[model samples]
Target: MDQKKEIKKTNDQIINSFSTELQTKVKTSISIIEEAVARYGYEGLSLSYNGGKDCLIILDLIHSIATGILPTNLTNPEKLKEIVLFYLRDEDDFEEIDEFVNTSLRSYDFRNYTKFATNSLKQGLIYILKEYPKLQGIFLGTRTADLKGRKQPIFAPTNGDWPESIRISPIMEWNYSDIWDYLLTKKVSYCELYDQGYTSLGLKSQTKQNPLLKQKNGEFLPAWVLSQKSSERDGRILSLSNSSTSTQIH
Candidate 1:
């Protein structure tokens, strides 16, 4: 099939698939997390929440489902427990975002990594897990469609450096619209970036305004908009599931 035709087919699928996948992903995520906690007998699990809209949604679902198993729901805005919420930002801007995640959030672990690149979020998590080996599993809000590098996805058995604690992503199949709809329905509080024109939210420097919000061709783009030659992708550092992995193109 031609590349253009494939894009069209996927775009059409995003509409119906968005809602269907959103619910499915949430349920799937819940089941996986519960199973891990039940089998491993963990008191709590850690999440690398980036203070974005999708992260907020993941926190909500985790709180709702994992409460039964772990008895430690970090995402619950009401319980106000101290679960770690990690931030990767420049030293200059850390104060404000830290305050927001702390004061605004009812419960959090409240960890920050300054001087390290945002890509270090993964490495930081690895370090934390290594230090505190009791943590059974980890959760993230990464969806397949959000990252261009993750088109055809494998839900189970996702590989990572921190393999001891099985990695779980509840919203793995959700589309952008599905995220928004779920947020609206659940009334979860998220960062205000989504309302402002930004499609993919990340560090202040790395994030870009959505190209497709105003144009048809711009939607569903990966969060990182900077284009580089394929050769350069190798040198770039990327983070996923609280672990840093090299992007080596063969």
Candidate 2:
């Protein structure tokens, strides 16, 4: 009982802290983001364009702050230049993410590249380091409220080994409702997945569509597909292929 009380207290304190931080910074987040662009030099900046609502809002803010004079042209729709958009398709869902990105965002620089966050971060760092050595950093749309079982991040991550490029999150203290309010006031165009009941979007194979995920720890995959005929065939073929490859190596 004592331990439970302590845990409850900790959770309350964290929520309070985030509420306070957001109250203080909500008005100034845009200025701070603009300052980052000026301080870092726009030419050295790039956003990790994921084509999600959060990422789209950030990109829009960057454009607003720059007053139409942003350094990089990849994400700029006016430039028609290519920027990498890390995404994967859901074969079972029978819908392409690009169909949404194209019709909604009206852009083509959206490259379908990233399949997972962990792997994408590694590859993004390597690509920047190798291709654009002078690039300063990348911005992410991560928020304190987004983490499932995390202590909200307050400062930049430093102790862990990272690429020379900096990673920043200006809206880290903001919540989902806060973001929605801002989007409404600013009238920014956003991805349509949110209306369809997806809080986060990823590969169709990995992503699930349910708004109650946070409350229920819900399973996204359909139960009917569990023992489907194609999956069974693929399983056998995969096993046989592995065995044959191992025998050849031997």
Candidate 3:
């Protein structure tokens, strides 16, 4: 089949598998992207993608809309160099994530392309803005399940100390179960670490598979099986995570 047909097929499969509530959520998220692109005109907007599960969903929606499966009235760039991309790549992050991001970077063309992070997420934001000075906003994959994202509004400005930019979280209302439901049901490709029982990802040295997923067979279940939302970060060394928020999560 041709590319457009294939994209439509994939999109249909994804949408059909979602529950009615989730279907609305997905469409709302798509509309959020449409609104952002309409307001920012793609070039003025940026995508804060880092090969995480949430961002994977964000990217998929963007692809579908851009390809006309979801239909944005605006002219879809045959390639989505329309909106820019940025990621805060740290040397200490997981190799699997970096590999996935690199592979995606090649296809999506969203990199200002830096591999560094200071002691804080705010500093990372500062650097991203400095690199992409013209960007008015960025689409973040942040969800309520993430501690930093719990209180965040769907649309908000950066904190006073952080560099100024609008942070658009399309999936802000989605819960833990909602996330896994969408990813698995859509058959979206995600980072391999998730299959290894990692519910949440942090720096490679500090993060591990969720302890709560351990089974009687000396093996552990995947991230999707973790019963408690609060225990998602049980594998991470909290002290370091408290100091520096991870790029892997968003």
For all candidates, what are the clash counts?
7, 3, 0
Relative to the unseen true structure, what is the Cα RMSD of model 3? 3.5
TM-score, predicted candidate 3 vs. hidden true structure: 0.83
Cα deviation of 139, candidate 2, in Å: 0.8
Stretches > 4 Å off in candidate 1: 1-22, 66-85, 88-99, 107-119, 146-165, 214-250
Per-residue lDDT of model 3, residues 35-68, tens digit only: 7776777767777677777887787777667666
Candidate 3 overall Cα lDDT vs. reference?
Answer: 0.72
Off by over 4 Å in 2: 1-26, 68-96, 102-119, 148-161, 211-250
* lDDT per model vs. reference: 0.47, 0.45, 0.72
Would you estimate the TM-scores of all the predictions?
0.59, 0.55, 0.83
lDDT of candidate 1 over 1-250, digit per residue (tens): 9965765565344333436655466556556655545544443456655566556666666554433322222244223133334444444332434455555454523332222334454565566566556755555666664455645332333355534554556676666566667666555555554454555444444444554433465444332222332211222233323322311110
Q: Order candidates by TM-score, high to low.
A: 3, 1, 2
RMSD (CA, Å), each prediction: 12.0, 15.0, 3.5
